[model samples]
Target: MTLRYHAHKPLRHHPGMPETRLAALLSDVIRRQRQLHELNQRRLAELAGVSQATVARIERGDRSPSLPALERLLAAMDLQLTIGVEELDAHLDARLTEQAARPLAEVLDGLGLDRIVDRLGDLPYLLTGSTAALLQGAPLPTDAVEIAVRWRDSARLTEWLNAAYAQRWNARWGEYGGVHIEPEEPGEHRWLTRHGELRAQMCDELPAGIKVRHGDRSYRVVPLVQVEATDPRAADLLRRHRQRQQAAEAPAG
Candidate 1:
């Protein structure tokens, strides 16, 4: 009863989408689960240990699920939501191609100093560590893939990122490596709007000697060249995503 596209569906999809849009996709799945379960807000509220208002908000796609809240609701239905690497990449591709694609400059005129991720068609190596913080939405986009962009995509990009923060998707710079970034706080929206168009740089491909600094620490956006050597599945997943992204690329922008 999850959100799924039937085989005969006509909608076309792109490869990996930006991180923010994926939150909407996930929220849609939860809403569908509620519908298929034939459970109303009141019923879900009782079974999931949430109030009617809470259930209503989640189903309306106005809110994202916290881990514990998701657990409680899943438990209520004897179901669990599992996100594998495949599903994650698939969702990313769909999102990237959904909205109109802007040029690199239009995507980055306002964000901070940064570089584009190479390997265009599919972004296989997600900057899954401290590297993510160097970007706008992913001050820590690890475990989440990073899409290298130019100044062109900045406004829409930031708008998209602000949406992610609103949903509590973690994008903050984590204290240390291996510590996942999570937007678990209430004021995360404030954190997102704080960057009032920081200047950044971007080349069509990865460049050497590019650098970015936040506080006393510096981060870089180097190609994830080694991931392909180690994980073959990662390569395949990204290839599929790239195909989808290119296909979804709108002609206007």
Candidate 2:
């Protein structure tokens, strides 16, 4: 005798998440469905009447599918999207707010730059690039903490950072419009330690008075004006950072 099995209940999600995060979660759902059904992009596209490229893009996180497109795609797999309002966990919500409202100095100290600055001494340094943009109330994507010092301090700063991080320092000349000082860590045990190099500028003109005063300690940060006047790429970074903050501030659907 032939038997038919009932399908599992669909997964449900609560609302109030950022749109980008929600899109990412939905993308994962579609990808998992495709994998379980052993279907490729072309097949999914055929079933959903969407282009193969559209299916590929959605699955790869390159593009967010429209609601109609997503509904059709999910319907092909006998699934549907549900949106509901649910109360956020009080403790988690409070923690996120505290982190977002934390002062730049506290953030730097948490990232261990406070210790680095203390060891490196007051060499007329200012944190630069995206990190600076972030400190200036911009939500920027900063891969590493970039810093700048006077042209004369490059060699000394290199030595200081190498000793401080317990890694070999190598200066890649003529990179990022100046010498890029990267720390060469030993072995493959590198984790949680911001895996990008600190930018060291050997420029004559470095901004002043951009320090974050935290009680007795003062941490240097590059001025947004300086970042705007510097390289075109750096200026573009500031623009993108501002755009991200604007998008984040947008109302949730």
Candidate 3:
């Protein structure tokens, strides 16, 4: 059986989660718990007083069980569902807010931007995203050094990363060493290294950047307008920062 919810209403009234994702999470949790308990579908169904077909459907994400059904399934495996509230992206948001208040030069120093720039050595990169925003005089908080490099040059960049003992960041597995990095997939590719986190946006051709001077050094960074237009996260943070500044400056009512 398939389960559906109103498109306008998010699952459990959470701001970011959708019904489909919640269903998938439930499916994964149920399947993994059953496996951990060494119970097959038929055995689990017997313990939970549910049909084997119901177990199969739930595990396959073909059905969404009601609260009682879900609780029974979990109880059969000696597991229980617990819910807790968390601030989404709390760590990142806090970091951004903190960095937004500091000097851009200090932020760059903390990121070890010079080390990455020097390591990249003639690889032809332009600062992008929050890094670019900061270079363009917008105090955006960024945890990683973001750069755009040509697709053709990815191989060379990968070599540098590998030599520096960097590991590719995987969503499910965290970081692992010695994986080939390429622009085969679209969007940002990230790596964790001793120096810091590095994020690269591979492009067919390098984006236009303007020279900016900071702390007696010049760097090429994507223009603020382009960054605001293209990078939504950076743009949103910048927008919020500006709003806070405006509120602070406003006279009391």
Candidate 4:
């Protein structure tokens, strides 16, 4: 089945979007609307002043309707075709949550991480642990944020981070005199503001969905699916973590 995100209302299609992508998004919305209303192709065609074949083609991904045609089609389903900027991040977060409960493999497939990485410029950095989990609105056991780095590239990565997060770096190394960075202003560092308590690690294999960007931050998050699949201990850890969070958030009895 095609990946689908259910919307409480129809998605707004903005102008200047490529025709093919727009058509695909619109078709999904229309298909969902028709299913919600329990209307047959013939009924929708009659309501939209279109032929059944046309509606069939649109729903089947074989054709894209002109603007006027789309308007009429949406009107039939009590939806309006409008132009507006969509909150893409919020939409993506919703889609992530929608698939969170599925099998790890299924969640990975739906995320299309391979496809998403193609568009990102920076590479070779990983955002792991509870930080990634929280970004996607999933419950986590802890909030300690960690960025994984290749042991061979630790020095280079540290230099890059110091440059990127200038003025925040402590300019002093941890007692180990290694890759550890002592935040100058531990409680109010820029990295801390975006990713709580940033620390670096040298590792061989990073988790899935680990890239180099999370929202406005530079470190990318590993998808929870990957975390669960690659780390045998993750499931039990996450369960306990979530329970702790729920307990903390629960109202006084």
lDDT of 4 by residue, 70-185 (tens): 77888787776545566543344334344454554343333333333332236475755554565555643332344555666655654655554422322131111123343322
Which residue runs does candidate 1 get wrong by more than 4 Å?
1-20, 86-89, 92-253
lDDT of each: 0.41, 0.57, 0.72, 0.53
Best by TM-score: 3
The ten-residue window of minimal lDDT in model 1 covers 171-180
Compared with the true structure, what per-residue lDDT tens digits does model 3 show for residues 1-253?
A: 3222222112231347566655665676776567557677788999999997788777766656777898788777666665433465443445556676787778898888988888888888899999888887767777689998888888888778877788775333212333545546433398767677799877899878899998889899988888788788888887876776788899999
lDDT of 1 by residue, 9-104 (tens): 112223475534554554555555664576755787799888867665555555466767866776676666654345444544543443224332
- Could you tell me the TM-score of candidate 1? 0.30
Number of residue pairs clashing in candidate 2, backbone atoms closer than 3 angstroms, sequence gap of 3 or more or interchain: 0
Residue 30 lDDT in candidate 3: 77
- For candidate 1, the lDDT comes to 0.41
Question: Would you estimate the TM-scores of all the predictions?
Answer: 0.30, 0.43, 0.61, 0.36
The order by descending lDDT is: 3, 2, 4, 1
